[model samples]
Target chain A: MTVTAPPARGAITAGEPIRLTSVNKTYTTATGPLPVLQDIDLHIETGEFVSLVGPSGCGKSTLLKIIAGLIPFDNGTVHVGEQAPKEGRRDVGFMLQQSVLMPWLSVRENVTLPFAIAREKGSHIAPRVEELLELVGLSHSADMNSWELSGGMQQRVALARTLALDPRVLLMDEPFAALDEFKREHLGLEVTKMHEDMGKTSILVTHSIPEAVMMSDRIIALGARPGRVVGDIRVDLPRPRSAAMIATPEFQDISRQVREALAGEDGSIS
Target chain B: MTTIQTPPQPAVVRAETVPHTKPKDPLLSRTWVKVGLPLLVLALGVGAWEVASQTGLVNPITVPPASDTFAAMIDLSTKDYFWHAAWITLQETLLGFLIGSTLGLVLGALTGTFAVFRTALWPFIVAIQNTPRVALAPVFLTWFGFGMTSKVVMAAVICFFPVVINTVAGLSSVDANARMLFRTYGATTSQTFFRLTLPTAAPVTFAGIKTALTLALLGAIVGEFVGASEGLGVLVNEFNFQLEVAMGFAVVVYLAVIGLILYALIEWLERRLITWSN
Candidate 1:
């Protein structure tokens, strides 16, 4: 098994984007005590797309939640930039497994929700919302209710909503996991394109080995049950990857390596 | 920050993309299904009643069908008996509704806000709600006496529980993610209450109010049933005692009309007030 250096707890090195230090999480259950995550550490740099992958029951989602500040770890700390804030909310944006759009609001209103909440007296957000809608290719459905749109369209609205805050860090938990293969591939390309254009640091939690390989700058593979880092494969693949990249030998090689790492841990960890 | 603008083409795209299906016009659908059909049925029923009375198909003294009932209604209107009965009954119903709804809203909002209030008050509320107001009408009459005040109080009490139940349900119906999302923005508790909790609760509370309007009206009528000298309930009772079935039936029609009007009015208000909810 290959192991990467545990990310330093508090320090954000000159170029290091995010650091998780000895982060552990556990949940209390009626049956018994359950440990979701053990002391795990990893660092991701700016403009890096890191995918966390493991079997079901692994704490990939839990770790992403901790980073998003949606949940607190039982022990250890996480630093979004140099460190976590002392008070109030963090500016880190998040996308969940489900669309979670406000059913009552139109797609445009859903997209601009964070802005509406944070609007100044003279603040202008219409243009920003429009730009985001266009970017997500949802410009045409802005006026429609979220329920009126297809599931894929609704998720796109959710993505646009995440961008509404324009945060420095994006934490996504299986954002495209619900879509079909074609939609997933299409969205993966769009996400890659968006990441390249915006240069935002992102942590994606996914189950698909091919998806992790296709999208990430680095893939963090965790062992199942009491999820902990087992392998981190840096894809030195060149930029501007497209759907065509999945057909190439280089893409196949990275996919093979990540799969082997996943299978190896899958067999031994449980 | 750039000015917020909605993409305009979607409406057109949606218009083009929306599959042609049955009943595209919602207004037309509502008119045909909600209004026109009901009106047609009512008209036919009234016409049948008039025909039956004129043809002597039924005993005029017993059923007293349409013409005599219409004449009784006309007489009542001319003598201002209709207005007197309507005014008194309407007063009791409206006052009771307002008082009961206000108390319900306050209690509901408070209980929903505080766990202690919920624990203490919820059981009593449920008990009161399940207890039929009809059974308590005479009890209220005894306590407050057979007066307008008693009727008003009874009406209010009858209307109160549903409002409280609905308001609490609405307040607690807030989405968990939405709550967390607001918290993420550092929203104060009061901010969350007003911005998210209150608005979300509005539609549900309005539903309760819409339902309560009719119950309040029924309570006022029922209170009149127990004891009253000058309201519609009294008028109906007087006609029943004299066996003036047509006059009694006329008063019954008026009561139904009043109840229907209030029900429709509340429904309209609910829609108008919570238009943004949809």
Candidate 2:
């Protein structure tokens, strides 16, 4: 309930005070209007790292998309910063499960894309590109295209691209789910560190319970079908979470709570 | 930016779904074996023809030996008139290719970008594309005369469709996630088109260009058939009048070799432009 704090005023402003009040979404299937989300309310404070974990058909991605202003909800007011998600989208960066890096462009060009779109061609953009690549640890492979890099490396490039615009709120949809466990844990640590460094609010939609516990300040677990927040727990394990922390009791306990929340009445789905 | 995960659970990543761009040795992949195999078949075909002609099994008048035709080609290359005619054909083919590809690319991009424009003009474009180029050649000749203009226009018009279809396809096949990433960043329509859509479509467009370039030569030849002062197509027709079958065969050989060279040039450009070229 503490995490359900009211969003600040305005639907359009900087990326702060992301608020979703009574959000509802229904997808029209061949059978009829199938409600995907119902009466969901959540609030994320500035620079807070939150993870939404749930079973399949929980509308977790839909929720992320709703927050991202990428899809229309049947009802409910969602606000990013003081403005609507649509109006304030410029300050919202997104990372998908797939690398989504343009294969034809070099790693350097892919990351620089948003910069070029947001601003005119200027000398300043080059340094920004370097800074981002350094942040993502992709400084060496800047000249190579996605085909030349491994999946994990390509995803890192995507992370760099998302940050290129310097959005205040980052919406991640299982960004590292496709990566192996070793990579998933490695990237999970790096991303959390990066999140702390940037002080940007992030909402990660993930299926991995441990990942949610490892990186999140708060973990929101949703039930199956018409997903509603089933469990909201504060991850007080500590900041700058390490790979070793995954083996600790506090991390295990937090992840267990998340898993239990994910395992709902529809137990088999998770 | 946020890619969809339909199922909340971990779906196993299929090994076959992802494309592997492992570069096999470029030279080794396109080995001499591949080249030699085709040459070996061609040799067998030509040798059989030569034997058939020499044994009087096939009439030399109707089906001249490959040797006679190749010798005619060598002899014709020495003639200033043949060179001038081949040069004219090449010029017409190239000019037509350039003009047609430009028109197709620009128009395709424009229509692809705007739904209203596509809806309004697509019918007309389809009609023009479907009209037989050979049927229209005589009309073009009447309007522009038997000069290179008619041939060039014909070549351009004939090759136009491939670029349009391929460019539009390339433009549409842009990864939805990439488009969403652009939209999430508030990229303008022009920005998305130029940055994401156009670049993604470039390789596909280049493929279309290759097809169009080859077709350009065919269009030029058809134009020459309508009426022309000089061209390889005209040379074939001239030889036909005198019943010089070997000479006609020689013109065809020159055309095929020219087409092969032009196709190779397109492949070379594709290697340079396409970042993920296999």
A18-49: candidate 1 lDDT, tens digit per residue? 88889888898888889989989898997689
Per-model TM-score on C-alpha atoms: 0.85, 0.83
Using DockQ as the measure, which candidate wins? 2
Clashing pairs in 1: A125-B4, A126-B3, A126-B4, A126-B5, A127-B3, A127-B4, A127-B5, A140-B10
- The whole-model C-alpha lDDT of candidate 1 against the native structure comes to 0.78
Tens digit per residue, CA lDDT, model 2, A1-270: 112232232222234768999999999988999888988999999989999988878899999998888889988898887777672255788999998887777899989877677674667678878988998998898998677899999999999988776777899999998999999889989999988776788999988888888889999988877888898989998777788888999888888777776664464433
Q: Rate the local accuracy (lDDT) of all candidates.
A: 0.78, 0.82
Candidate 2 chain A, run of 10 with poorest lDDT: A1-10
Residue B222 error, candidate 1, Å: 0.6
lDDT of 2 at B47: 95
TM-score of predicted structure 1: 0.85
